[model samples]
Target: MPVYDQERAGGHPGRPLIQNQTVRIVVIYAIFGLAWIYGSDHIIDLLIDDKGMLLQIAVAKGFVFILCTATLLYILINRLLGQLAAADRGRLENLENLSQKNAQLRLFFESAPASLAMFDRDMRYMEVSRRWLSMYGLGERDIIGLSHYEVFPEIPEYWKECHRRGLAGETLREEAEEFRRADGSLQYVRWEIRPWYQAAGEVGGIVIFTEDITERKRFETALEANERFLRLLTDHLPGLVGYWNGDLTCGFANRPYRDWFGKNNDEIIGSTMRALLGEELFLQNEPHVRAVLAGEPQHFQRTLVKRDGETAYVWSHYIPDLVEGSVHGFYVLVSDVTELKRAETERQRLEHQLQQAQKMESVGRLAGGIAHDFNNLLTVIMGLAQLGMRELGAGHPTLVRLEGIQHAAEKSAALTSQLLGFARKQTIAPRALNLNGAVEEMLKMLKRLVGEDIDLAWNPGRDLWKVCMDPSQLDQILANLCVNARDAITDIGKITIETGNVSFDAEYCNAHFDFVPGEYVLLAVSDDGCGMDRETMAQIFEPFFSTKEIGRGTGLGLATVYGIVKQNNGFINTYSELGEGTTFKIYLPRHTEEGARPLPEAAPAPCHGGSETILLVEDEASILNVAVSLLTLQGYQVLPAAKPGDALELAQQHRDRIDLVITDVVMPDMNGRELVRRLLPFCPKVKCLYMSGYTANVIAHHGVLDQGVNFISKPFTMNDLAAKVRAVLDAKGEAVD
Candidate 1:
């Protein structure tokens, strides 16, 4: 360390520090020679003897000094060489460190994501990143150590000025800039320019960072366009549309939302649901709002009383706006469905009516079948009892008992008749009659049925039109209606029977189900009794359907009336409400054509024996036996046939004329019509008399008797049978009416 400063700073002169270094070396050599010559000679003399040996000693002394001087110079040179070697090592280490730091900086600039380039003070490229080369489309060329202006000659002078300013230690940057490439394509760029410094703290070069942002800009433009289109679409929609935040604050509203809430978008936006919809509506919607916010979508219907005082039906949907599996907000859609709701209700009502009609029709059919079977049994009972009474005479002890049996059978026959009426299969002997006369004829009977306290008033319309309905059916309608009215009353109430004329058009019938278009005679029965509700009225005419306790009613009164009206090609309608009175109006088609009038009231004619040959056909053996006995007792010679084929055989075999043919309408082998048709050839002038437990005759369709046919209902007494047979045989003019 001590020789280092001297060797380097001219303190020692081995390396020849100045131009006079050789003179210095020579002077040092002269001093060293004098010292060596003088010191060594004295020492040698002191250590040796004799003037004669002086020349030898002097030669040895000179050699010894030379050797010592050479040795001393070698030591100084070695020390200097050691110090120089240390200095050289330090310089090499510093250079290696600088070189290493420079390589690392070049590497950092090469692979950086940013399009970066490093330049020297003269604006020449020192280093460039791969990204910079790629962005500029210059990856293939080696542009290092080249001037920036030469590499990009197409760049604007303004950019060059920016580079110059950066090299002058100024920092410059651009957030966005438009540039055209060499291919005449436009591109957006973001860049930064700044200077780098050297170890001397002076600006070494300008570094530039560039980014290609064309794709990002394009994406932003598309997003803005989509937002505008969404707004336009939502505004044109029919439903009320809007978006709500998690806190129920309105974020957006479409055009219809303004009409729905009676508020514009400016007023509605940012408003809470409760504040906008009011307390009542908000409470109704609160549950759905919370659900949607909890990420559950909601759909429901509501009837709202709007601000205009009119009501509206709305179907609404609330969809959750889920982002990353969490509910951020919700979307709302509400549509008016007022008309649709009304139509749905009407459709349901019509469907119910159709189902009710189908049910009634089925009940009618069932009741008809039951009535037919029961009437056959009743015929045998009543016929046998009457036969017994005639044989025993009135004075016999068993005569009263036989009469009682006959009366009971008659009552059962009446009940079966009611069933047949409800089924619309009653044996109706229709007569063209005025409604006033029919109501008047039954008024006294109705009064007796209702009792004295319940006044049965007859309000007959003046000069009412005639209706071609059976008189018995009219009697039933009035009797059943008055009885029902009497039962309904807890206290004194009035039962009114009104007769009037009514006409229905096609339009009216269309509106009212089961009504047909025609002019009709209206026979209405009204009562001031406890009225029925709509539900009870709906089932009032169904067989076995009654409101009264089990025994109070047989439940067939109104059903019978319904069947009677329908069978006569008419319709019935009733109106009633709870706490109000009930009114039943029956419309019978007006009888414009010629029709038979009901026979006048007369005494029963004395029974007389018939001499006419008769054909009696019956399916039931007992009824057939009874009918044959009855006819035989009346002195008519009868040919009995169980089947229709037997009746044909009997007619064909017997050559004598069959004055009359009494055949049951429904038979096993064939119906009475076919039997009569085939038998007509054998007995060409035979008088036909049809009998049936069924009200509707096989010879007549739907209870309209065929022309030139005589008909009688079954369950007849001996007297009734004798009277009908004699009448048919004696008809000499036209066929029995």
Candidate 2:
């Protein structure tokens, strides 16, 4: 303010034109006033000297006129001088105001926090404020009159173009630009430039304002790098990933998504979901997308077709991408789960099959147990009937009725035995025998069973290894096959039986479930008859399941065969097709032992009795009565009781009298063995005869009879019962006490 005031009070000191104008105005005003005053004094003296009477009057008028004129001139001159002095003061005040405003603007520009500069139309710096100078590490003297390129030599070409545009009257605003400092370090700057205009609206220079945003720039660069890294991480993920905009258009997608969708990135990006997946899929997914848009994450499953024309099951999770507490889009992740779904379905099917198998097995075990018990009762009835028929003469009418009753009971007993075999509870007596020899011996019986209408052929292997199996079961298997073959053939057909050795390998075992790798004796029976379909073969082993008409056949034959083979640790395979005939192959485990000689066939003999005191204990009253009568008729003194306690009392009363104890294995109060233990102390010399319908191992603990003890299975005839009792009582009995 002080310097500006001094300059303004004296007018601008360096401008001579302003000073000269003031001096010329002051001189002209003073000269005009002084000349007017002197001229009026001269004119008044002339007018006063010429004093003739008329002339004096005229002179007086003239003098008066001159004096008035002089007075008017002097007044006008004073006014002019005063006006000049006021004008000078006004000029000086105007200068002082302009200087003050200019000084304030200079102070503002120099002290501004941001960098500020004024560049001429040529892009040369006309003025640079202190902040601008400091930003560039330069003094005012170094920057002024310098071109922008000189101040920042490392400025990009684009920045130079921006400066040029600004100089050409266009405003330039750029977010960032790189400039080089004097120390060769790069500086990132954000700046704006506009053309500075004078009062006449002509472009003067550019006013440029800039901010150093180096740290902000670095932060932005780091953020971009991190985004790239995250994208890379998701690209290699196991599932597809994508981002959708608010309009459900794909904004971004990872590599997996592009590959899975079979679309180029360019084709998918910015495309609406409906365009990519079709309207059906898009509409179906609308609810899930809406949930995500509403700021809820959702999981869903879908079946989609891949690019390769294969269908795939996909599990997807959609999460909202939120900004400022509002959902912007969705983040979608999808995984293919087709195989998992298939596995789950397969597992459920297998579980159902297992449950069915378990139920069947349980029922079979129960049926087998009941059949074994029923057999015992039948044995006693049949033995008593046969004994009654024998005691009566052949001409007696009662003998014919008794024979019929025995025949019916024998048929019923045979049916129960088949049931026991199917349930795998029937006892088997296995002996090592050549399968070829066994088949050869059965050919004659098999031909007779199949009938003369059907042709039977045998293909026996000479060097076949021996197999251990129950002979009766083997015969039953052969008989069943022969019957089945006969039924299949409507007209004449050949049934071929082939026996050989078979060795299964690892590959063969893998293909079949529950099959072991081992040597086996193979018995194959082939029939050129009306074979079976897959459905029939699947359930061929099930009891009572048959394709034949009612009463035409009992379905237990094949079932019995299956049970026997399974119990003997063997496998049976059936190969047949409708109208193509059938083949049944049986695989029996190979035996290393030598084959045994065949047993001699025995002739039927009559029941024989002994003079032994037999204590017979049975729970059923009729069975007890009949058993006592039968044994007494066979010449033994039979002591009978319906209760275990009575039997014990009888044993105590006749401890020395009873020579043998024949008791039922399953009793109400005490079992046969328990009764035997109690009776043994009282009758120390007694030989025991145990009877039961249950299989040998199940009732006698693996057919083990105590000292001086023997066993008789139930459903026996009169001869079997009589013979067993006699054999036990006649032996040298061991001391039971």
Candidate 3:
């Protein structure tokens, strides 16, 4: 046994309680026995008279002494035995109570809801809760005396250090740390280790409390990862995204939103809207903000000036984040639509231009149709007048009246020509002519037309490019433009005519609705006159739309100019503000090849008679009768057919080869070109003359006579018809046959 245990057993050192009581009884007996012997001897010596009597008294005293000693020893031993029995009983009771308390304490440890364990100072397990046992996978087993390290040999050095500190009376705690168990499995553990004290106020052992928090930690980790992923997604989106609290404080902003504010997330989050947007912008957006906060979603287009001073058009959507009918905040989604807006505007403008062009086309068709019929009537009237005056010779009685009728018909014919010009059906021959030369040639005549009240200035550009257009059409354009300019000048105004070579690019043409990307010859006429307003300028090219008094102006002037420009595949632009000068810019495509064919000289003055067989085909009876008479007056064999089919029948039956076939271009049965084509099989030697007032859908293409095809306009005088016939007969180039 240990030395302390031996001392406690009363073997080596001082004894107290039961042992002291035994010693006290032994001393008392020794003192009493000694004193009894001494006292009895003395008493006998003093009281006895004879020696023999003294001996007898001593024997009695010895008996008495034996009796007294026996009695005293009995009393003392019994009392001591009784005291020892009581001490043994009290010790047994204490042992029994301690055992009960220990059992209760063990029960408490086993039944605890928490995971717990108690260990002695030597790190041996004293008790363990059921939870601890289950948690560590330790089943029902007597492990009360097992060493902590032995029970779970995989304990880390750090945990061992914690345990040592706990044994040293230092309490240690760790929450949610990794714990690798003996089975190579992992756990997140929250634990505290502390020293348990003994009743003597000394450190007894250590107790550990632990909880497995793996599931909770896993939940937290997943939540964090999901938040990070959402943030990444929002940041990469193209549209601006942001969130705001009910207090108008910014809570979240994606990458585009952050960039727009010129701030990072850290700086932007929690900032007030007023601060980020600035006072003016906030004020502008305040109503929208209020609406969104009231749970009303808003979608609108807005124009904003950015921080960098760039203008931006945005389509914005504000969606309210409502919770149970109460506004929590709002989400913003904005997309830039500046380019789309521009494209839309351009599309509308182009549509408007298209509508205007279509309207003009319709009007031109009406005018061309009118001119076609009028020219037919005028042709017969003028032809008959010429034949009448010619057959009667000079200075006859009815000659003056015939001349008056001829003159009226000629004037009416000129009016129809203007209509044809405006209708874009005027027969024209285009040649590559330089704009500078054309303008120079028109200077003298334009000056005479504009009058002395206005100065006509011609500024021809250096190295002016050539344009392809009819020379007569150019003259008409110049004369009409000059006349309009002269009328606009009430008192004294200057008209400036200019020519230049210009190049247009795609970008410029995109902005200019009427332009194309190419080089052009520009003919500009500017007049510092009583300029036109926008309303007047818009209708300036419409036929019969005149600003002048009824007697002073034929509205066809500018209309004809517009038609001629359009007919040559060109565009025209006019710039004028009321009371400021007016300028008309005509852009004709540049002629790329060679110099133009020189303008033809005037036609021969008088008629040249021909005795050739002539087939005159006309749709109108009056025109056919007059044309046949005119040809017969010129001493030609005339075969006149009012209808195209009749003309074809006439050709088949005719014996001699026909010299010339003059046919109306647009007839009911056939066109002049078709008639000529049919006649070619029989009269292979015949020459052809195609005549029409307006040949919009006939032998001419866009009113322009085909190459090598003889053509004449209607309302011709006898001389005019004779000259054209003589020219056709004298020409070296044969007909289509």
Candidate 4:
């Protein structure tokens, strides 16, 4: 039936050798028997003498021959028996070894972890392992002797072909298939079908080894779905997110990372960190990267310059990817904080500005108080000196000394005026005036002031907006700014004066606290000269805070400009860099109106005596005495009082008409405006001239002269008093109300 059985049954080398030995033995035995028979007969014939004796002798000899022949046959039979017994013992030993090997193979097949089975060439199961029966939900008795298709009728043709191939001497391994069992359960099986050969090299059967891989396949599917979800999450995040491997090569990058770096996913993935970030950036970040890879988390801020040369602030965090208590790689998260940083910077700037403003306000109040007290004393001193000068005629020797005293007092008064300006207490008379025309008029004076070496560049805007500010105040602003510009330049440089119409919006005003939203007249004075540092700029508007050498400056120039601008409801901004240049831009609210022709310049006021009856009220005794004497000498009837109550008494006693009342604005008994209000009930027809060392809110509103109110600043000489008194008496307007 089988090639191996046929070979063993006929003409085998060992069988032929055994046959030859048996034939030889048979021939030898036959020869020995023949010789014994013939030889014994001849011996019997020779040994016998008489017939009777010969018969007896022949019988004995024949018996002996027969015994010898029997002995030889017994020997041959014993040899044959011994040979057969040894052969039988060897055969029994071989059979016992084969049986032991078969038992071992059966144990191995049943104990296998994988489902293993053996089938004949006919595809019938020869044997099945316990694992195979368990895996396929079958019993060994049910599967053995059954064909594969018979055991599972739903087996696909591909699998059947695989079985056929195995039986045809082919070996198949690791073919995965979804196998449906008879019980209606499905299994993902990866199996190996190998043809097992007999000793003669012919395919006798096949051994199929199967593994259930359903769980493994399901796990792979879940893993893929999770990966896709993770990718989607990272891609949609606003921050730049990425993962790096142990080699510092990028394993994955989010959409932001790719877009920000101006690269695609394919270019970023698998690229080294150093390669993706240029060498400079890589070097900057190398330490952080190393630290993260060393299992330490890192967070820091960096400034990135974009392709358009714009700067951006980024906050980055590098978190190490820890696996099994060791570092595998790191994760990167980057967020743009440029706007946040800018807002913070702006906040700091505004805070500094507010502090400076508060400081200036405090200092200004102190300066104003000092100036007010000093002005009061100077008023008494100057008033007495003027009286002395008038009494001592031009021919008198002491008249020259009185004039000197008068000049010194006048200089002190000028200093006080500067203080008032810095304090924003000086009265201003505003009129709508074109700035361009004003600048043009100042061009000549500026040229002479800055000297020939310094170039003057004046670019005045056409159709400039009219500014409602005191013309004298404008002159002071321009003069002081030009002088400062001149002093800043150590060598030949240029001074530029530019005028333009500009507007500030709400956003700009929000950033700069002092700014307001309106159309403005922009006056910018620029100089290519030595600039101030931050410390100097911070104190620039403070009174007597000068950078110049001692005695070279009073430091009130810029302070006065600051006061004037603020009083006019304007803002000033400065831009400067050390050793580069400086620019001061003043923004004054524009006055919207049709341009008017310039007014005719009026001749200077002539000092003259006023004959009108006047009430003079002064808190200081010296000022009171001097003013009464000065007016008495000028042929005017003067009622003098040291306080408001005394003045009220004098006014009531004087039944005659008192043409005017000259009262100190700040007095101990009462303020001038209140005194005026009270005195007005007594003498309703009396006009009042309010005088103060410094302008006060009683007589003025926001350092501006109230309309129809007559006022004068103190520290006046006889000439100033004479001119003001005459002008007030001659005025053809309604009496002070």
Candidate 5:
């Protein structure tokens, strides 16, 4: 039977011979027979009074003894059978009590929360809890009555040894066990085995208690993986990162932090913040650290100096780690923002430059518009005065006055030219020229302009590149820059003019932001004088903006230089420091073609009389009258008209051959080009010369004369008109000058 069997009832196994009811009854009857035989012989001897009745007495005695013995046997058998029946009833009650206790024990084992099972000494499954079966993913039928090895054939030898030790009355417990199930999945289990004892205190079987902790183990693994990934991410970041405990000691730091401080993790992990950051920085950041420790997040920007002696701008963030409403530690995050700050500053500077350029552009347009109209009025005044001087001659008293009037008008016209220069509207005559020779030629004039106290130095470049620009404009640029230098000097100062070749590549252009990538001729003018500050430099290009005191300057000098440079597709850069000096660098595009020879100065041809009829058109009354009168005095028959329609009528009525047609460029009735187009039908071969104060956009592109167009700028003398008219007539094809 099993050691812990529930079938054993309350009883002892050993028995005594005297306790047998049948044996005891047989002994009693034997004793009684012996005693009765003896007693009957004695009674017969004592009663011998009647010797004759002796045989009858003996037979009576035998009958009486038989009866007595039979009765005794009957009574003893009945009493013994009654006692045996009572004992059987008591044994039945005890068996029923044992059965109830067995049922209760089975219920307790099956209802346990933990997985439990019992195996006999033979290792066969004796009992299993519902939880044990469910935990092993098995039914009751699968494990009950089966041997431990048969049920879990893949169990490790170690576990089999544990079972053996348990059966030997030793208890075994394992906090963690890796059990590889039959389906190839691993299960984490915590289990214990102990020997179950019988009522006699002997070892019976082993009982196992197990708890599945697989989910908890999986959670731990995932948490570790996530921690490793986060560490990797923070280590590679460009910004410094660290964690600090409440005691102000660093608990962790990423790669950037280690590199910046020139320390490894071993040296830094437990170091105090004050030691790592130094005394100064630690004190500077103490308040923010305190705020974080008080459970408030802190953020600020500061400059951190590295171990290499370089400084970095950082945006620092400290986020407190809170646990159960108490401060634990803080996390540090830093971002390098040095480059971003620099870019923002550069953007603001460029925006300011753009605003200044736009302001100059608006002023230029306004000044150009006014100068154009001013030139027209000066043209009429100069023409009438010059025509009067020709008619009066040198002998007349009015001749001197008329010459003076013409001189004043000519000066006024020069002033208008300066205005147009500032406006970037002056007519340009571009041609290839060598810069070195040009600078050499201007040195004498520049010396005179700067005065004797100031010295002028000309450093001409060798084998300089030729540039396609107007020589007159080049002279203007040099003159303005020199004059500005002269004014800036308070005492003896030196002005240097230099010429050289420079090449700009894409990378340089990108850095400068406003330069074109090409080869250029550099013209730099430097002055050892009172230099300008940044505020003055920014406004220097604006029209009429001057640093000189009132009445000493017109303020158009540098403005004109800026306009001319831009008009010629060049750029200018200026560098200056207060009390140091100033230098202006001008870069003009280099022309690939060979330069042309400088034109020789031409003398004016003498005005002579012509007999051919002339048709002259002018919009201004005074200009038209003076032109007609001057041509008539020169022995040509003149036809004057103020409007294009009147000129057309005059052309039709004139039967004689018209030798020339001089017309004003801009008129209400029609432009000079259109007038010529219509009148050519009447005078097919007549030479035409178009004259204007300034050529408008309709007849010229950006103040440059159109190709094959015969044009002369206004405010001309009588000699100029005569020469231009004759030149137009002399040309075999279309005339440009």
Candidate 6:
């Protein structure tokens, strides 16, 4: 029999010993019974055969021995029952203790907050806590004994290697790992795996603890996306972009910003702004940046050097990038403004030049008006002088002196005409004329004007359209331009005059300022002479502004051409460069009915004086007296009035005697035409002769005389006035009023 230790069974040691004594008693009883049985059987047989009292006595003794042995066996049975009860009680106590310990361990593993799992050496799930099962969308029944592949089939190969490493006694603690769930969803987990150790310190299994880190992973992903977007935006931006930390250090810079600083990202990052841009430019911009970081928005201009060692001007804006309503850092945005500033300066210069030109033009008009009136007076004086000289003998010294005086007055008159042309007030009689024919007529004169060394060329286009312009003005324009070209040439050069009909379409018109789309007769003059610069070209149309030295050329030449061309509803363009030639193009509108010709010129005939009396009205008493004297000399009875009112009174007094009414066009009270209307009813047969020292409004307004009315420009000679008076009186005498 194997002896059991009572302490090991959780029972007292004395009870086990008492149980052993009872077992010893039961063993002695069994041994005695077997021996008595053997002896009784043999002795009983011998006593019966020999009839001996001793044999009967031995049999009875063996029975008594058997009875005693039965008694002892009963006692041994009782003791054996007690020892069996004690052993059963100790075994039951041990089972109860084990059940209590198991309940405590179950409570601990089931309620743990951390996801807990147990894996076998093969990386198969042996046990998993409730948290681990819930996390993986699994029940214990479905996951237990399942391989990692069965639970998560989509795990990456690297994850499998990690699992293997953990099972091989290597601990793995990865901060982030992606796990695919049974529902086909992904989870980010931060986990630690440690090998489970046996009592002997050998690896048995693996224990894993994991945490869900999906929100943190999402945050990181969003941060990366924003960074990538910012980088792409800055890469394609048009100007420099950068970021500065609170310490005025460069924290981030785009490609353009880095290039502007003559550095790369690595060289600029974490560097002070002063170090990147050098002390000069950095110090200049430092205050602005500091202001921005101090929560004030700042905008200013700065010049920065580029990687190619060139400087560029920029309009820069420094704005604070704020956090929690406080200045954190600064963001810089820059744009190039050099061209805009240059354009503004150029505009101001042009405005100043325009103002000067306007002032000179105004002065020229004033001087021209004065000269026009004075020239008319000189014409009268000169004509009188000529007449006096003719009356005197040619041998007389007084006649020669008078001739010299008349010549000087005539030259003064020509000067005044040029002045009037420059002022755009000169009388123009425009008619339709062929441009080709005009150029042909100018060729001879142009050749002489350009000098002997310079060649004159004409490229006249066939079938060129005719333009309506004054022929004399065209001649002057060509002469002035030729003279300018001659002066520009230092050596032998060529001047070309070209004429053609050009149709300006919309495209061409748009390119040329103030040009209209239409059929135009183009007159182009080009010269192979030293050309003028932009400054000279701008002032070339200004009166008194000339490149020629004193007395060589009048600055009024080009100004007169400009005024004439503009008055003709034409456009002029010039192209020239230094050391190159110059070209001037004059575009005049084409006239549709250019083939029509003017009526034949009437020959001047002798005016036959009549006995008819003439009533002459004049504003100036001297002109009225002079005219009366001249008409009396012509043998016409003259009645003169100093004013239109007096003239009307004279007409009424001699209604039948007054055959004609001669009056000044401009008067302080009534004009000549108005005076004529008033006198017409009183003396219906009277014809009118309108005269003025200035061109009458009726005649000069349209550059022509009114039909059936005679006009005499003032400062006329005595004979001119007499002839006009005689013609009016004679014509009225023939009329049957």
Candidate 1 local Cα displacement, residue 53, angstroms:
99
Per-residue lDDT tens digits for candidate 4, residues 636-684, read 9998989999988887887357899999866666778778778876788
Give the alpha carbon lDDT tens digit for every residue of 1-737 in model 1: 00112233344332343334446546777899988888878887898787768888888877887797788667655655665566566546645765676666667777666788878888888778888888888967999899888987777889888988998889998877898987889999889998888656888787889988888878977998998899889989988899999888999999889778888878999999899999988999999998999888999998999888988899999999999999989999998888789889879977986787688788778877877888888889889999999999879999999999989988887877887887778766777788887677777777888999886666677778888877878888888988898888777867777776665555345545687766678777776667798779888986677898889998889978887887888888785645445778888888865666753433334868778889899988977887888799899999999888788889988845678889886565766777777887788778878886433221242233474567765445566688889988887864323
Quantify how close model 5 is to the true structure by its C-alpha RMSD in Å: 29.7
lDDT of 2 at 142: 73
Q: After superposition, how far is residue 635 of candidate 2 from its true place, in Å?
A: 79
Report the C-alpha displacement of residue 234, candidate 4, in angstroms: 6.7
Q: What is the C-alpha RMSD of each candidate to the true structure, in Å?
A: 32.7, 31.7, 28.4, 29.8, 29.7, 30.6
lDDT of each: 0.78, 0.77, 0.79, 0.79, 0.79, 0.75
lDDT per residue as tens, model 6, 1-737:
11223356455644666667766875786677677777766766765666676667777887798689778778777767776777667657755665665555456558776687777777788667787777876764577788878877777898788878887879889899877766778889999988887556778778888878788899999999999999989967878888988887888999878766667788999998777777887778878877887899998886766667666678999989999998879988888766777678778967976897688678777867788787778978898998898889679879878988898897886677677778888766799899888878878878877778987777787898888888888988898888887888888876777776656545334544697866778787777677788878888887777988888876788888898889888988876666656777788988867366753432323555556687878877766777777677778788878887788778778898877777776577866667777787888766777775432332333233364457765444444566767665555343322
Residue pairs with backbone atoms closer than 3 Å in model 3 (clashes): none
Question: How much does candidate 5 score in TM-score?
Answer: 0.38
Superior candidate under lDDT, 1 versus 5 = 5
Candidate 5 deviant stretches above 4 angstroms: 1-240, 250-288, 299-316, 334-359, 377-419, 431-434, 448-455, 461-468, 480-496, 500-562, 570-737
Pairs that clash in candidate 1:
none
Q: What is the TM-score of each predicted model, taking all chains together?
A: 0.39, 0.35, 0.35, 0.38, 0.38, 0.45
Using TM-score, give the best candidate's number: 6
Model 3 worst lDDT run, 10 consecutive residues: 695-704
The ten-residue window of minimal lDDT in model 6 covers 695-704
Per-residue accuracy of model 5 over 390-471 as CA lDDT, tens digit each: 8878799998888888889888776777778887798677998898988888889889889999878776788898999988
Better of 2 and 5 by lDDT: 5
Clashes of 1: 0
